[model samples]
Target: MSARVTLYSRPGCHLCDEARAVIERVCTEVGTTYDEIDIDRDPELTERFGEEIPVTFVDGRQHDYWRVDEIRLRAALGG
Candidate 1:
């Protein structure tokens, strides 16, 4: 389930920060990597993810919203 991890985020988002921390920690532990996209920078992304920031995508599919579950992320990444 875990391939490319993408964090759809925005500036000044506390939840996004938390989610990013979890993603960074997990991905580092698992030797995986992720990309952080500021929704504010992209119109389409901002529109799609406007309401729910801190959205996560695994392998280009939506995984979690608003938060990152470390255990679930670890399992999904096959760690």
Candidate 2:
């Protein structure tokens, strides 16, 4: 199966932005598809991940929260 990645973020969040950029660059290099989710737009997601805006998931599993670790991400994606 193809790898799936998702980023949970909100506007004006510096860490979120950084996480997105990291995901974009790594996903591009690793040939993976990713989607960004704005937690503010969803009540359940907002409640579950409000404090940790920039949470990331790979294949529907929580990969990281608050920050992006490139090495962990690469390993998760089998890079």
Among all candidates shown, the one with the greatest TM-score: 2
Model 2 vs truth, CA RMSD: 1.5
Evaluated at residue 35, the lDDT of candidate 2 is 91
In candidate 1, which residue pairs clash? Answer: none
Runs of candidate 2 with Cα error greater than 4 angstroms are 1-3
Q: What is the Cα root-mean-square deviation between model 1 and the actual structure?
A: 2.4
Tell me the number of clashing residue pairs for each predicted model: 0, 0
Error of 1 at 45 (Å): 0.8
TM-score of 1: 0.92
Question: How high is each candidate's TM-score?
Answer: 0.92, 0.93
Candidate 1 yields a Cα-based lDDT of: 0.89
**lDDT per residue as tens, model 1, 1-79:** 3448999998899999999999999999999889998989889988887879899998788999988999998888889
